[model samples]
Target chain A: MTRRSGTAVLVAWLTLVWVGLWGSVTAANVLGGLAVALVLVRVLRPSPAGAPAVVSPPALLRFVLRFLVDLVVSSLQVARLAVGRRVELRSGIVSVQVPGASDTLLTVLADAITLTPGTLTVEVDASTATLYVHALDVGEGPEGVQRLRASLREQARAVVRAMGTAEARSHPTPLGRTGDRRREGQP
Target chain B: MRDVLSAVLMLTGVALALVAALGLVRFPDVFSRMHAATKPSTLGLLLITVGAAVRMREGGDAVALLLVAAFQFVTGPVAAHMIGRAAYRSGAGAQAGLVVDELADVSAPPA
Candidate 1:
């Protein structure tokens, strides 16, 4: 994006946030917001912006709906296991690559995934764009790793659709899937 | 009916918080405890704010409540990631009941 547009977008976002925080959209609020936003943007001179995400409202809504469902389901699962008498779990950290994720997309994906129970990020390998996820429970065996890895990639795809660059949105396949048993047509 | 719905949501949220506390005490390790701390607690906060918002039925205040939820959603995961990463690199998970660890073979990401 051009310098002018980037500055405009940043100022607009900051102003919107300022208004939203104040819980009013009066003329005073808008003017104050604009003043603060302009000052912050011009004075602070935030880090240069990266590849702009092509946001799709419908896809964002869908991703949020799915994440909420995941939140509830995973929370309940953890709650049940927590309440059980003798806790037995097969926790493990698996390194999985997210296909087509840039720094921004990867951060969003990690945040969304970590917000849900059952899985959290142990570490991040930004060079390879990999996430080391520590799962609370991974069921029985290696298939568990497969399942979790696939789930992570699936969420990345959803994130890409919601707010990612066009190239990332197109390249949704995890490159390591070439030999995996997961079929192309499987649900 | 609105009151009833709000009560139910609030109660459920509190119950989830209780579950989180219970998990924190019962879970075996730091990572597991963090799992307990992160998810249910955030969900609990969400449900409570949503219930309160529903109860209020005001347009402006609901926006503020939504903002609280948004900030929590954004920051909670980041805090958990930092702690989890630290715990892992410190070898805190060497005996944390791992069935497999792929990261063991590969070096952790550059600090």
Candidate 2:
């Protein structure tokens, strides 16, 4: 409940990692981990200006569950794509506008997308609040591109809802519309 | 019964790792290759760790295995993120038949 609880969490996680790497949980290992974790937390503490948003536990749980499902599904999809004889690799970059998200949230969103199969985050343009994602199979053409953009936007929105502040939710941009319009005008 | 379960888990883990290795060789591009490298490999490693923990049947070992899984979960995405960024910056994605270039405007200086 204290302000240092966040650091405590980081310390606990680091301690666990240390124990895991050591492959034992002896008293010495635990004490060493604790000492290391404390020093690390002190040295690498987050700045007040870059404080993470208060996460909604229920929303975060939902997001995690859905993300797990997506991970399994996409892994299978990628596996199939890799092995399939007809390699229809329509790889492309799609831009998504995510307004009101903090730096932490935006980085989380990019990491999530990259971790999922068939997609990688290419660039994050902070000025325009845009994320460029490279997808393995963007499908046929403009319609397929629109569908991918919509899904990516939805994923971004879910992350925002789970971990973003009310200010972020208020200034919502129209999902996929701007990109869709631009694609439509393309020959 | 425990032995049987451990054997099954180990076999499944090995199978997954083999598939991941196959995908690494068979996949055409770096982005797709990265996809093959991260997800299944992490799951495979977790499953193998769990199988070993089950066989060990020691509380401390189990806890250690759990920690291993947790660390893998934390680091896998980070590693993938870095690799993807490097590949994109190096124009590997474009060489792999990239259809659209949304980041062209922003990432132009690097290329």
* Candidate lDDT (C-alpha), each: 0.79, 0.74
- lDDT string, candidate 1, B10-100, tens digits: 8999999998999999999898898888888899889888888787766778778877877888899999999988887877766686887
Docking class of 1: medium
**Residue A173 displacement (Å), model 1:** 2.8
Q: Estimate each model's TM-score.
A: 0.86, 0.83
Error of 1 at B10 (Å): 1.4
Candidate 1, after superposition: displacement of residue B98 in Å?
A: 1.5
Tell me how many clashing residue pairs each candidate has.
0, 0
TM-scores of chain A across the candidates, in order, are 0.82, 0.78
lDDT of 1 by residue, A1-187 (tens): 3457667888998888889888888999999999999999879998644566777899999999999998998789778978988667888887667655667778888888887658998787776667888898887887877888778777777888888776676763533473232233311
lDDT of 1 at A11: 94
Cα displacement (angstroms), candidate 2, residue B21, comes to: 1.7
For residue B67, what is the lDDT in candidate 1?
Answer: 77
User: Model 2, B42: alpha-carbon shift in Å?
Assistant: 2.5
DockQ-based CAPRI category assigned to the predicted complex of candidate 2: medium
- Model 2: residue B72 alpha-carbon error in angstroms: 2.0
lDDT of 2 by residue, A1-187 (tens): 2236556767898898787778777899999999999888788775532434667889899989888777776667766765677575888878887766767678778878876767777677665567788788898878888788888988888888788755566654634346442454531
